[model samples]
Target: MAGMVEQVGPPGRDDITAYAAERTGGASVRVGALAPLTRPGWVQAGRHLLAGMELAVSEVNDGGGIAGRPLELVVRDTAADPRRAGAAVEELAGLGVAALAGEYHSVVARAAARAHALGLPFLCSSAVLDALTEEPTDRVARLSPPQSHGWQVYADFLLRAGHERIALATEPSVYWASGAGILREYVAPRGGTVIELDARALTPAGLCDELAGHRASALLLLAGHPEPAVSIVRSVRRDPRLAEVTIGAPAGQPEFAEWATLLGDEGTAIPFLRYLPERLSPLGARVEAALRARLAHPPSFVAFEGYDTIAVLADALRAGGAGRTRPAADWSRVTVEGTRGRIRFSRTPGISVWQWTGAPVQVVDRDPSEPGRFRVLHGG
Candidate 1:
């Protein structure tokens, strides 16, 4: 009988802590997707947006469906248009989604603000421009590092590389312009200056003339448009003086590779800051499979971001005692692990910063295998 006891499952190790899966229940939380899904230009990034949201949903469901009730997502395509974004928000609210995510473009973020005003919490994953946070609502939360943090990281990279004098090519849009300003603010205080070049409507001659005057050590592309940024890089690289300067960008879009191809082998050496490593995400793989399964191709960062936004919201809802009470933790303790990074909102200043969240900024060597892929050079 003693020999037959068989250890009894190793004495049960320890008591089981209640997992997130244990409590999720009925009255399914309706999570919404707000994005420019219809626009071809946005198609590249938007796919990643959706993947992030889907990943969160799928993972929650797989882990016993969030407090016993599975999450249901309501997706809305904003088509990169503000008017359409507003309409989609109305539609999702009508369907009664408990929370929402997505909307990378600042234009669409405004639409999200309207939805949040109506009581739905809008948790953004990809849209990081500071303007999005200015919208008054406790319902809005962002997981991505703000543009200021990203700018500082980029500036630090250039400065550390000994490129103290820099030239900037920036888009006129609030997102890029404000991002450039933030970069300048960070760079200037550190004894470096960033000269701005407004590329909104600059002719080739105008761009050349501006480039000719500056004895720049580095070039920073503050423009969001890949075409223009690539064009500038290609044009500048031809000039012997500019060819020697290091070119830096926030993130490399596939279009940057096209630009690299045009610029030749020299372009491959350009360094960029990556917010999220493409291959680092387990959810990214799942997102790609889902996109290929449904849409016949893999998704992009924007789509995965959209999916992640929803995933974070689902976590918050689950942690918030399923609407019973707020997830009451102090500012330092108030954190939610998000797809992009850990999210913690500041209680006093009442704005989000990368420091409190503990997200690392990485300087990466762009992947040779995939132009969009990257390997961490410093931080991970």
Candidate 2:
């Protein structure tokens, strides 16, 4: 029976405690949210991520919450910095958050060592580094496939598309490095050859020259950021010799509209590995509508992942109650209907930790006429 509560500025320890006290009336479940709210590179993505988390929290509270206790989010800004991320987790722990979620950068998620140390259940929303959940731990889980698994899916798509020689290009980052490594490991054994290129170091002319020099049937641009990937694709498409080369990117998955607009005609028919299906589930539809109403755009992959993270956490809380250690075990058995598909987790191969392995991985391309619409080439 409490009125809607709103707080201005970034949440601090005292802010979180006071907000929860005012909103929950002393009986609420607090989930910690660590994201890059003001980071230079990740501010927009961070906003959408927070929006999704808020949507999920609102829906859970509207539905009587977990075991009739209101769910509250204690948000902190990490700015995608590793040290800040680790400290944010520690701060959240000090605030007595039952679980933690919301991180977009792999470097930041890697700093989740504190979550393991504190034994608080941490669900990574969108960080895709393979090592995030590589080690077995009862306190950690990820909702997105690791870079290796996602790249393997991309490799399979390329193989099925009759492309044998693939050129891999990427920026210098841990996220892209893990993806490139997986592409190399997966492509060679499958009778495919990979030509690797450092996209960050390449000038537009140099990129075109390199693409012209290689007889690659397709180019896999794995830049973790969108600008480099868009630049590479735009440059490659201009080369007459490589005019027909199939272009794909993992970076475009999160921010598809910007990539598509930057590439223009060049973006058509290009494949990208994405976490969500082209179509939404009933829950997905509701989330998309809510996002459109709130943010004036449909939920992006980051938003969907964020929504699912809290949904999964709520399910775990409902089953195990608050303050229960080892919620990862409970998370492993939870199968919530998410925006993408039926959300579930299992121990990832090679990583040896429970992860949301069933995330809908699809190779989708932008519709030439409809800039925002994507057509699924493979998977669903």
User: Candidate 2 has which clashing residue pairs, if any?
Assistant: none
lDDT of 1 by residue, 1-380 (tens): 00000011224212211122233424455566766655433555665566556656766767765566666666667766778778777877776666666776765775566765566667776666666645345666665666677667777877887877888777767777777777778888889988888777775446656766887787777665456766776677676756577777775443233444555544555676556553445645555576557445445445545655655565667666444234211223346554445556653243532223444456665565655454565443
Per-residue lDDT, model 1, residue 9, is 27
Error of 1 at 225 (Å): 2.6
Q: What is the C-alpha RMSD of each candidate to the true structure, in Å?
A: 10.7, 2.9
Backbone steric clashes in candidate 2, count: 0
Candidate 2 regions off by >4 Å?
1-24, 324-329
Quote the lDDT for 8 in model 2: 23
Worst-scoring 10-residue span by lDDT in model 1? 1-10
Name the candidate that leads on lDDT: 2
